[model samples]
Target: MGAATPSAQGPRILGSRGSGSSPATGPEAPGSPLTASPGGRMGLPGAEILVGLVAGIDVNMPCLGFALVAKDLEAARDVLRVCERLGIELSEPFYTRKGLCVTAVVELPWYENPVHFLRRRVEGYLRYMLPDVRRVRRVWGRLVWKRVRLPAAEADVLMPLVERLLREYGMPGLKLPATVAEDLEELVYEWGRRWRRSYDWAFKVATGRIFRAVSRLSRRHVVLVKLEDLRGIKRKEKWVPVIRRWPWTRLLRLTLGCTPPWVGVALVNPRGTSSDCPACGGELKEHSYRELVCESCGRKWHRDAAGAANVAFAKPVEYLRFPASSPMNPKKPGGGEDGGNEETQRTSRLVDKDPQPRAPRDGSRPVAGVEHTRQRGPIEGLTLTRPQTLPPGFPASKG
Candidate 1:
């Protein structure tokens, strides 16, 4: 795999928090009627746009966490309406492959702690999605090519030559003529820089406990959903993160900015749930963590894709629980938490316990050894093995 090139680099900004000014005030203020309502800011302007959905995927080494945010009731309804028309059942867990989609996957490196690893993974995912060289080229080419139709042979030749020139000279990659390159490069650079900063700020805000708590406080009516809850829809769930971070709504506004005759919904994994025989809800047996395997029906699914379909059809109310219950919460009132006595909470978070027993360095008999006889260890009979079946739609190469 290629090392991910730094799309754009600059000092990270953690949003308006440090500025002491609320994020609700700036010209591009998040809570503004014109700006998108992130984290459920109140009194959001009616979504004049037909469908606005925000999906977030928390990428993890083992499983991806995903959530969807629809700005208005109409947008959510539209999604449901489409599912109904397509003959997809929302109540049942299933995948829907529809539309241009993006997802995030939280990655846990072998050495890093889960929380830190997840934080970094989220930051990286957001940066990857922002405006970058590759995205610019792809979008630019499409726009330029659409207006001027040339003979197939001539058009192909010109495009390649232009690309080569840009590469050889270390010139900024733009489809326009050399005369316009200077201006376009500056614009591209500024746009990329701003977006990179915005992404960094947004990421910090999203992952922090403070932000999450504040979000809950601000939007009392909002229901937070997690990808794990949608596991029944798809057999595997790796790409749920990608689906969540995809800026579909932003892309819509950017691309179709004031156009009246624009209408489309892109689905990435369409065959996810519909093609499966609904009679066999037995397909559910396949869902373990992120893999969807139905032994009874002999059907398999990529967990993420299946979940995405289910997400498209499922009502927000059905999967409204948190992804992880807080382990820090006190089970007993007198005990502070973590099963420790009240004193433990006042002193420090650590729990005191008897020293762990050490294991014998080498196998030895209880007496003199002819051949080594092993004693029953704490985990003597238990074996740790890799998961037997891969989640559906997981690329074999990923394994």
Candidate 2:
């Protein structure tokens, strides 16, 4: 995290729900055309460029919260202002010293105490198997009781074969019963089926949320994920079962598998992602069950959103570096002994825009990205406008 302070202007509450019109209900519709190509465009010769926004994702049990922050500080802030003015998906965008951070939380319908659900399923299997096992044991015991009634020599011969059969096919430790192997197989199948259903459902929901977020924003180049390793955490014996069953690693795999080849996914450390404020690097105090407030700046934040924004701004601990000239990179490497690429020089640049839309010689004006012919709905009067360009000599600190 960077060392910075909150704006002296105080928290402006960029997208808070209010007593007036909904913050999502803007005068103009927030929809804008995504004009850049997926992955990125080729940069100037020998210049390494990050052609799109960096996406940071915070994966939690209740929801997957994500925030998009541009590599260029100024562009990120501008994007925040634009999205707020347009009211995109009723999302919350917060202004931070790093840049304008836009966040969205996708709710999940996954089972709480998922371990309990699996245990209940196992109990159901036991219920069905108990009667079968008891019946087989009783029948075997009755046969043994009749052995004494038979002629001595005949009983000896018959008892040996029956006992051998029981040893071969039954659970011998408790005077084994028949069909136990088949019963065990059925129990395992049931457990697997139940677990697989829950796992698949969660991944599906997460994939949909990721795609939806990407579609709404402009082009994105990289996704930073907070790596949550729950294995080493201490827990009670009862909780040990729950922690072992956690699907965080599988969810991380889903994030990796579902993204486009051009999108670089990296893992960042999870420590303090939610505890620290996104606006300032101050500790956050619990404000509510699901909210936290910065102790230093007094900024309130949703627990998950704050974590996601932190992931967006935090440095990645693990990432696959692409060759500067690769399609995924779209930049040329400079001739240097260290294989250094000049891409960092271009990191502060925004996605190139087409020359501002001009009116036709027919003497009529047209909105840049707005479609006037579309039927008016909730965003009927909304028009999309680009943010004003900053002066060349504008202080980088203010940006």
Candidate 3:
């Protein structure tokens, strides 16, 4: 779902949570009065429970990095409670992995240009992030292909069905309280304030703005926890020792909840795998860049076609041809002029001893009785023939 309005660049607001300054502003403020309470015990119900799909979108350009863990009604509500405590913005329901899915979109703002921002952010999250754009595109393409494979178009029309389901589930027109903006501002300030000792004011402000904007615009409930904050808590508290303790275990039981069994994890980019030839279990090195040549058999195909074929589950047809001979070497024991001479001797041994008539080399019709020329004529008979001629009008003078 979309946010109420586009984020505006303004001075840092210290402790604001919603749109309006009033505490009685957003969706959760009414049910839980402490939602607007300054420092009282604030309690909210847990989120809805359903199968979850955790999708991480790492944008390279503009360096926007977002992670979404989407669950059904129960889990979503619990997540919302957590987000509310932190003063993050919550949006209305939207379609996602399944029909009528409620999502929380977390926006990440990068101060630098898109390219530089993405590179740096991605390097930080490399373990969780996919490498190439093609991998991300492929994941989406697979989803589309699944729909195309469906027998009926209606069976695969996910978006429309989700919209209908959401309407039926009483999820339309859900709005955020005005005070959420203020709380969001406070949370962002705290996040940035912690880093103020090490970072400049500009960095803190810019980062704070990004955190708030992301919390608000997220499709589902978004929790904007700084990476540094998490790391700091882990270092000081030592999570392993605390997890084993009694009261902390019960108090933070929600965090220990196991994910649903049906949740699927899809790897965006598998390492050392060729995107083109997924079927034949062949690699790009099997062929040149432009042509796909098989090393096993002398089969050749266009590189693109080979890639497509690799994806398709098909048996390869073999064509027989002469095998290429290896180059002969004179120095090698079995290769060289000596080997050729041996082969010629062997061939001669295979022939009969009887003399046979040989053909003329000049290509003239052979005279049946005459022998072919074998030697040159003597030098004494090599004189040139003189031309015979008559005087001008000699016949008339004789008459």
CA RMSD per model (angstroms): 28.4, 23.0, 37.5
lDDT values, one for every candidate: 0.35, 0.51, 0.31
For TM-score, the strongest prediction is: 2
* Ranked candidates, highest TM-score first: 2, 1, 3
For model 2, the superposed segments whose C-alpha errors exceed 4 Å read 1-52, 71-91, 110-112, 124-185, 215-240, 285-301, 321-399
User: What would you estimate as the lDDT of candidate 3?
Assistant: 0.31
lDDT of 3 at 16: 33
In order of appearance, the predictions have TM-scores of 0.22, 0.48, 0.18
Residue 22, model 2: lDDT of 26
Residues 185-285, model 2: lDDT tens digits? 45545655666687669757765666544433332233233344334543555444345445567666765566544455555667889899887789999
**Highest lDDT model number:** 2
Residue 40 lDDT, candidate 1, scale 0-100: 28
lDDT of 1 by residue, 1-399 (tens): 333233312111213122122445542365332332232222122322323443433323333333344455543554455434543333323332323232222222222222333334333432343234345654554433211122221233334544554465443543443324344334434544554455444444323322232132122122223222333333355544334434334322322332112121122223334234222444454556565676566665546444543444332222121121122324333443444655536433454453223445554323433333356656765655767798999766532
